[model samples]
Every structure is written in C-alpha cells, then in structure tokens.
Target chain A: MIGRLNHVAIAVPDLDEGIRLYRDVLGAHVSEPQDEPDHGVRVVFVELPNTKIELLYPLGENSPIRSFLEKNTAGGIHHVCYEVEDILAARDRLIAQGARILGTGEPKNGAHGKPVLFLHPKDFNGTLVELEQI
Target chain B: MIGRLNHVAIAVPDLDEGIRLYRDVLGAHVSEPQDEPDHGVRVVFVELPNTKIELLYPLGENSPIRSFLEKNTAGGIHHVCYEVEDILAARDRLIAQGARILGTGEPKNGAHGKPVLFLHPKDFNGTLVELEQI
Candidate 1:
C-alpha cells in the first residue's frame, strides 16, 4: 500500500531555470543538480517541510524523459512518487487489481538508489506514478 | 517563501473512479467527496502520511478544471500548492521578479478556505503553482 508522498517529479526543459524558480524565487531549500546517467536524468532536490520536489532534465540522447520534455516543451509534472512497504507485494497486489506496471514489470534502481517501479499513467487518472520502497 | 507542499491537485475526469484508484487500488486513506460549487469543483482528498493528493473533477457548467480535463482527457496533475507565510508579501516579491500571477492579482479563498494565489504556468517551468497562505 502507498504510504508517504515521497516526491513530485517535474521535468523541466532547463534545469538551471528550474533551480532558480524553486531556490531563488520561491526560496525553498534546493540541492545542486546531480546527473544520474543510469536513470538518464539530471535531478535537483527541492526539500520541503513535508516532502520533496524533484526537478528533472533529460541527461543522455535517449533519456527516459526526453520525449516527455519534447511534448511538454516548457516543462511539466513528470510523476508522483509514493513510498511503499514491500514493493514486490505491492506490485503483486496492483497486478491482481489489473493495474499496469510500466517498463519490464520489474523494480529498478531509482533516482534515490531505492527500488522503484513505474505504473501506467492511464491506470492512474493519467498521472504517472512511481512507487518507491521505503 | 514556499513552505510545505500543501497538496498536489489532480484534475480527474471521473471523481468516483479516481477515488477507487487511490483508495481501493493504491490503498491510501481517502476522504469523502466534497463539492465546492462556488469553485465549480468536486474534490476528494487522499491523505498521505506526508501531504495530500486532491482529486478534482468539474462540478458545474463553468468549472475551472473543465478545460484542463478537456485537454488531458484521462486526468493529470493540475497544480502544486505550496504554503506561504504572507501571501501579499509573496505576491509582491513574485511580481518584482517578473513572474505573472493568475486572476486579478489578488489572493482568493482556496478549496481549503485559505487565501491562495495561482502563478502563471509559462513563467513557472510550465508548472501551475498555487501559493496558499498558511
């Protein structure tokens, strides 16, 4: 079952601008951008009192969010990550409920080095969901 | 200026189906549907451990999210609400920084009965940001 609202990922066309918007303009505590080539993203963490806002930009040519950025252009909310206990069990439950898992239907090393899986946006009110193991 | 992430608003095409996805499928604590006819929205709150996910659907003929739902079809992240200490001060600062605020540049009563202001998506990395006075 979903626990905490881990983070809301926003895909920005420009990472520096995204950082400035959240850091300088909004005055939130923001982390420096870190490139995660494995995940094909350059991410910055905007820490809030209750949760985090992840600013993501495509890293490589075939970055996972490249097409998303292309369609969104300026930027957009990429996905919402929720914390879950026993991700494998959660995946099975989601499957039993006829929910679709994205990718190869296996958990992968997420941006936080935690096991994470993507759920189809169509099955989630058109909102892309990421379930991260706590 | 931005504090806790108050909530993430998702504009869903179907309110009951949205509730079922979060409550029945995802197993999150869900609230009963509350119709804010004044705001032209029917809302359901998914209470997460850290924050809340607001499931929004059009309530009246001229619902604000009606156009958004038309574009998104299945539903999508409508906006991210952030808590602010002093909304007027935040508005002035945002204006000074060349940011555009939606509406008549005055804070209005939000769904939570707090003064809130919406920023233009174009100036916010394509993210519609709502700043609610806490």
Candidate 2:
C-alpha cells in the first residue's frame, strides 16, 4: 500500500512567483526547476524536514496543468503523492479493489526519477492521487 | 517555516464511503470518525508511515464542506496541512511576506490538538494551506 507522503504538488500560473513565495518568503530550500516533458510540467521541489512540496507549471499548450489553471485562475493544489514500496503490487491491489488508474495503466518516470502512476480523481474522492515507488 | 506535512484533507460526501475506499480498498489504517462541530465537519485520519490523510465530511447544512461537495459531487482534496515549529512566528513571517491568513489572524486549535492557521488560497497559488504548530 502507501508508504510515505512523498510530496504535495501545487500548480502555479507562474513558476517564478511560486518560487518566490516558497523561497524568498517562506524561506524554504528549493531545487532548480526542471522540465518534465512527459508530465507536461516544469517542476521544482521545496524540501522540508519530513516531506517535500512540488511547484508545478504548465510546460506545453496541451499540458493538463494548463487546463487546471484555466478552471482555477490562480492555479491550485494539483495532486498529493504517496510513496509505495512496490509499484506493481500496489497498482494490482488498487485495481482489484476497483480503483481506476490514469493513462496507460503502467508506471512512468516521475519527477523524482522513480516509477509512478496516477489514480483517477473520481476514485480518490476527487483528489488526484499519485503513487510513487520509493 | 514548514516542519512536516501534517495531513492532506479530503472532503467527502459520505464519510462511510470514504472510509471504505481508504480502509478496505487502499488497506490503510483509518481512525474512528469524529465530529468536529467547531469546524462543522466530521473527520477521520488515515495513518501512513510518513504522513496522515484526513477524510472530511459535512457535519451540518452550514458546513463549508457541504458547499465544496455541492460543486464536486464526488468529493475531493480540500487542503494540505504543514507543520510549523512556532505558530506565531510562522504567522508573523508569512504575513510580513504578504501572505494572508484565512479566517482570523490568530491560530485555532486544530485536529491534532495543535495551534493552526490557514493561508488564503490566492496567496499560495490556489492551494488552501494550513500551518499547524508542532
């Protein structure tokens, strides 16, 4: 099942603004922004003592974050990630229990360079949940 | 600023259904349901290795969660709570940095029996963030 709270992702309209809020204002250690073309996002990680916060911005026109931003003008909390020891086992268990996996039903390389899969928001009480292998 | 991820709150239409999904399906350890009249919401905690998941449901007609569910019939992620070392210090720092605290500027007793304050969604890139003093 789920292991740790890997990171909470917040989609921001402007990556620079998001960085300023967390870095300059909040005074948190933030990583360099990296383009995740596969996920259609530009991401930066704000490291914390026990968990991390991921700042996400749209990378391409068809980016899902862009659509989310359109619905929410200021952008918002996009997803919460939970770590799992075994990705396939967790996926199978969740599937057996009638949870819908997003995309191709296969794990992909996530922002942390680990295998990850996204569960449909409808199945998770309208919150997009990401399961990452750690 | 932020110490750890306290919990991710998800507003659900039905508390029982939410529990079933996380407990029975996800195989997570869930706490007993508790009605928080002060917040006008019923809450339950799903314990994980790293962080907890809070399942929230409207306790009364006037509950804010009720309004959220009206828009999202399927229920969804409500807010993310981050732990802080000192609530007052965190509040002062954030306020000085132009972050608006939700409700009153003062902190209130949170679910985990800690002083907590909520930041406006607009300031945090549309994420309703909760900062709890640990």
Candidate 3:
C-alpha cells in the first residue's frame, strides 16, 4: 500500500527557468540540479513544508521524459511518486488486482537510489504513478 | 510564499470509478463525494498522510472541468493547490514578477471554502497552480 506522497515530478523544457520560477518567484527553497545519468534526467528539488516538487529535465537523447517535454514544450507534470513500505508486495497486490506494471514489471533504482516501480497510466485514471520503496 | 501543498486535483471522467481505484485498489482513505456547485465540480478527497488527492468530476451543465474530462476521458491532473499565509500578498507579488492570474484576478471561494486564486498554466511551466489562503 502507498505510504506517503513522495514527490510530484514536473518535466520542464528549461531547467534554469524552472528553477528561477520556483526559487525567485514562488519563494521556495530549491536544491541545485543533480544529474542522474542512470535515470536519464536532471532533477531539482523544491522543498515545501510537507512534500517536494521535483523539477525534471531530460539529460540525454534517450531520456524517457524527452517525448513528454516535446509534447508539452513549456513543461508539465509528468508523474507523481508515492512511498511504499514493501514494493514487491505492493506490486504483487496491484498485479493481483488487475493493475498493470510498466517497464518489464521490475523494480528499478529511482533517482533517490530507492527501488521504484511504475504503474500503467491507463490503470490509474491516466495519471502516471511511481511507487518508491522507502 | 507557498507553504504546504494542499491537494492535487485530478479530474476524472467517472467519480465512482476513481474512488474505487484509489480506495479499493490503491487502498487509500477516500472521502464521500462532496458537490460544490459554486466551483462547478464534485470532489472526493483521498486522505494521504501529509496531503490530499482530490478527484474531481463535472457537476452540471456549466461544470468548469467538463471539457478537460472530455479531452482526457480516463482522467488527468487538473491543478495543484498550494497553501499560502496571505493570498492577496502572494497574488500581488506574483503579478509583480509577471505571473498572470487566471480569471478576473480576484480570489474566489474554492471548494474548501477558502479564498483561492489560479495562475495561468502558461506562466507556470504548463502546470495549473492554485493558491489557497491558509
């Protein structure tokens, strides 16, 4: 089962502009961009009181969010990650309930170095959901 | 300045189905549907630990999110509401920074009976942002 709302990831076309918007305009404490080559994206954390807003930018040509950025050139919310206690149990339960797991149904190391699994958007009311094991 | 993320509103085509998915499948504590005619939408709140996930459905003929539900069919993230200490001050500061406020540029009574203002998505990295005065 989902534990906590981890972070909402927004794929931005321009990373600096996104940072400036959140930092200068929104007046939020923002972290410097960290490159995650394994995840194929650059991420900045906008730390709020209760949760985080992750600003995501494509790192390379093969970045997974590249197409999403292309479609929404100004940037848009890409997905929301929820913290889970036991990922494999959660995955199995979701699978038993006829939910579809994306990307070979295997847990991948997320940007936070935690095991994560993505559920199919269609099964989740068109919202792409990521489950991060905490 | 923004404080906690109040809730992320997801516009769903079917409110009942959305409730089932979150409550039955994802296993979150979902509230009963509450109709807000003033806001032109009915909402169900999924109470997570830190924040809430609001599932929205069109209420009547002039429902604001009717077109969005039609476009997304399955459902999609409509907007994210962030809490602010003083909304008028926040609005004025956002305007000074060249951020466009949606609608008549005045705070309206949001579904939760709080004064809320919506910023133009184009001005905010294509993410619809709502600022509710806490």
lDDT of 3 by residue, A58-107 (tens): 99889999999888889999999999999999999999999999989989
lDDT, candidate 1, residue A54? 96
**lDDT (10s digit) by residue, model 3, range B88-114:** 999999999999999999999888889
Ranking by TM-score: 1, 3, 2
Global lDDT scores for all candidate models: 0.95, 0.88, 0.93
For candidate 3, the per-residue lDDT at B129 reads 98
After superposing candidate 1, which stretches have Cα over 4 Å from the reference? none
DockQ of each: 0.91, 0.80, 0.87
Best by lDDT: 1
- Chain A vs. true chain A, TM-score per model, equals 0.98, 0.95, 0.98
What DockQ would you assign to candidate 3?
0.87
- Say which prediction, candidate 2 or candidate 3, comes out ahead on TM-score: 3
**TM of each candidate vs. truth:** 0.99, 0.95, 0.99
lDDT of 2 by residue, B12-85 (tens): 98789899988887778999999988888999999988888999999877887788889889988889888888
Those runs of model 2 whose alpha carbons end farther than 4 Å from true positions after fitting are: none
What lDDT is reached at residue B30 by model 1? 98
